[model samples]
Target: MSGFLPYGRQTIDASDVEAVVEALQSDYLTTGPTVARFEEAFAQFVGVRYAVAVANGTAALHTAYAALGIGPGDEVIVPAMTFAATANAACYLGAKPVFADVECDTLLLDHNVLDPLVTERTKAIVAVDYAGQPCAYPALRAFADRHGLALVADACHALGGSLNGRRVGSLADLSTFSLHPVKPMTTGEGGVITTDDPDLAERMRVFRNHGITTDHRQREQAGTWHYDMVGLGFNYRLSDLQCALGLSQLARLPVWVERRRELAARYIGLLAGLPDVRPLEVRPGVGHGWHLMVVRLIGACPPGFRDVVLAGLRARGIGANVHYKPVHLHAYYREHLGTHPGLVPVSEDAFARILTLPLFPAMGDDDVDRIVGALEEVLEDVR
Candidate 1:
């Protein structure tokens, strides 16, 4: 047996621990200035006017959907090749999630297929930044504007990713980020919603904290013990302790993202001549976060080839995995959306060939070499 290399892992330092420790020592652990500070800092980092911290990525998505007033009878277009949360958020709002095919190269939503999916019922588009590469935002934005749809960037895998020099969280009407432990940065488990719209920001803030009109800080500062419940909301608030960890992790995000990019470049160079595997095409204008370095196994590879390669990598201490099955292929979606196998051809085809190789900021040259070596060996065996 050898040391297991996970597909993704958190990189925490002494400073991160110290920040959490300081928060633990403070009187206000859950509701405090740390959360506010984190929100402000995150908003500034992403060039957004406001940010609302929430419990997790799903909560962030749900809150964003709710804030946008998406409900039953409305349709939200989502890429099929993303995590289920992207589509599930629409379901949470009792809104239908219209599945769209992805581009063959980047695996992000294909704007070409979007127009056909738009209807009078379409209220929004939840564009995912698959594998940390930002989607074609300008095209998507134009499409959304043409259809009068709200564009939400499900940027959970793309915190540090950007397009046309603008950051991912600032590119859409509203953007959501996940700070899960395995992400580029971590707050143990947390998320944030960013937007420039003041009313949307307020709606998100209200929805994240039990629908309360006033937060604890405001109540405490004003010495008012009573509060009003403005609307139906959830207990989706992120604690100050988590926010402390987030602030510290955020400070190191630029360095971490750069390292991930370097690792991705190395993977690209090492895998270039390998005939059986192809890296996803990254367009020039985007700054990819490289959260997961996914590759498509090409040629006469069978449908089970990805699983075989994944198993081989695991046996060699390299934790290779798949990014996702098309959301429409999921049982729940098939049952609810009445989606069948052949609905999104590109997304389904990509799903069978795609494999997520181990990638993280802490990975070194040797790690890359080991993964490359294992992949080469696996491909040779398959051939």
Candidate 2:
């Protein structure tokens, strides 16, 4: 039998280990030089002017929203199909997250639906790079500009992706990335926000360091023991150790993304002849980062058939999993936001059918074949 396959995993090597060890022996550990180095390198990679390191992806979102001055009575439009953290971050700052429906094919936020959701209270449009595919940024950008709303890219799933030669991080007013074990890269657990706006970057830097005017490094460099608290903030600082690993991992990202795309294409080709299963459509001009290799059951498949297929795959050690339940359908959102079953019909419909297959840089072609073989068996069993 083949070994168990996880939906995703980190691709660590000896170099990554050495980098962390070197940082451990360095003079500064937390939020120090290595963190700044990682931030700078990441900014260059994304073609952004500034990048601010943070504790996690959710912190990146919260800090970005806060930097945009999102506050009480403000509303931030979020795609209904993303991870809850996308919406939860806005709520953390006392701003409402208005859930928007996604396109049926890509599960990306549909720009067509934004017109009815916009209101005077809308402060920003947080577009998620769902499954590592870049959203239709041109359309979304035009809409945000017309409505006087700030555009934010929740690009945690799309770190290395590009659209028409423009990188994902440079596609919005502010862009966020997650360097989790399962993502395109790993810092163990870290996040970074990228932007061209200097003011926004500085705000995020201060916000991550307990809202203090200067961090320990700055104070020490100036040979002063003074610091000032400008506002309330969380200790959302990414450690130097994490950043060290991040630098090593970041160096490997381009190669890794290429590998991911190759694997995704292999899956697409292997599954092409399968009945009632189809991979999400990739939009033209998109250089998909392929964070998740998602497929949906179609036609004659029953409403709950996705869960059954997921169970079958897992039972066979395939490690298949669902990408998400729509944010509005989650119990917390249902109660708190008064969201109901049919609130976002397309999202709810997609949620019932979609499942994420295992895909990572370290995975081999045979692994892809094994997964597809298992899926084929699962479908055959149901029939």
Candidate 3:
């Protein structure tokens, strides 16, 4: 049998190895020149004026929230279908997370669903880029402008995605991305926040390093040790080593994103004829980065049909996985926020039927064929 096909993974070549090795050989490993270079390259790639590298995507969100002054009693509207990080970051700043419904097809925040959820306490709107496609940014911008709410994007799944000719990083006031192995790029474990606002960028830089005014390198160069804790923060800085890997990965991102799009098209075409499944749809004028090729099982899933299909696929060495369960469905949210079953009907429905297939840059046609074949077999058996 062939090896297990992961839902997603990183692709590292010799060039990536060389970049990490070179960083290891350098004098500064933790916070070095490489971090700055990576940040600059990312900013340029995303068409943003400033990018702040953080330890992880969650940190980027937390920093962004803090920079926006999101605090006690403030409310941030978050789509209920995304990773917990989307709402958790708001909670980190003692802000309340108001749940929003996503569109049934794309699993993205619905513009039509925003009004009922907005109130005077609404401080921001965090539009998630679900399954790598950019959210409705123009509508979101209008909504934010009308309410004077801070607009941010939890774009962890959309690194190279674009909306209406604008890269995701520049689409919101503060956009965040993840560099986990499964994401579009990997830095082992890292994240970045991109924005055109200089003050927000500077605040994030300080917040990532324990709210210090100057980094260690700056203090060392001045031949003095003078720094102050202007605000409460954490050690959320990305290491220079990881930044080196990220930089190398960033160089190949354009091609990788294109390949992902191609693979996604192939999946869509192959799955189009399947009556039991429906692939997530991409909107017009938006470029999907194809983070995860998710499909929903249609109709009555026959009790454990979903689980049985997942088990059958795994038995055949296919790592079919569930992209997510509704954020509010978790025990903590249920207990703390009084989150109940029908908070967002569409999201809850999706959580029950969604299944993510393997899709990555390194995958080949044979791999796609293998997954499709395995899924077909599983579906036939379950049905």
TM-score of model 1 (CA atoms): 0.98
Which sections of candidate 3 miss by over 4 Å? none
In candidate 1, the residue pairs with backbone N, CA or C atoms under 3 Å apart (3 or more residues apart, or in different chains) clash, namely none
Local accuracy by lDDT, each model: 0.92, 0.93, 0.92
lDDT, residue 59, model 2: 97
Q: In candidate 3, what are the lDDT values of residues 1-383, reduced to their tens digit? A: 25988999999999999999999999999878999999999999999999999999999999999999999999999999999999999999889999999999999999898998998899999999999999999999999999899999999999999998888899999999999999999998999999999999999999999988889999998999988999888999999999999999999999999999998888888888788899998889998999999999999865567778889889999888887888999999999999999889999888878889999988897888788888898888878
The numbered model that scores best in lDDT is: 2
Candidate 2 C-alpha lDDT tens digits along 279-331: 99999999999999999898865777888899999998999988788998889
- What ranking emerges by lDDT with the best candidate at the front? 2, 1, 3
lDDT of 2 at 161: 98
The clash count for each model shown is 0, 0, 0
Q: What digit string (tens of lDDT, one per residue) describes model 1 on residues 1-383? A: 23899999999889999999999999889979999999999999999999999999999999999999999889999999999999998898889999999999899899999888988899999999989999999998998998888999999999988998999899999999999988889998999999999999999999998999888889999999999998999999999999999999999999999999999999999999798899999988999999999999887767687899889889888888898988899899888779999999999999889999989998897899889998999878867
Of 2 and 3, the candidate ahead on lDDT is 2
True-vs-predicted CA distance for residue 303, candidate 2, Å: 3.7
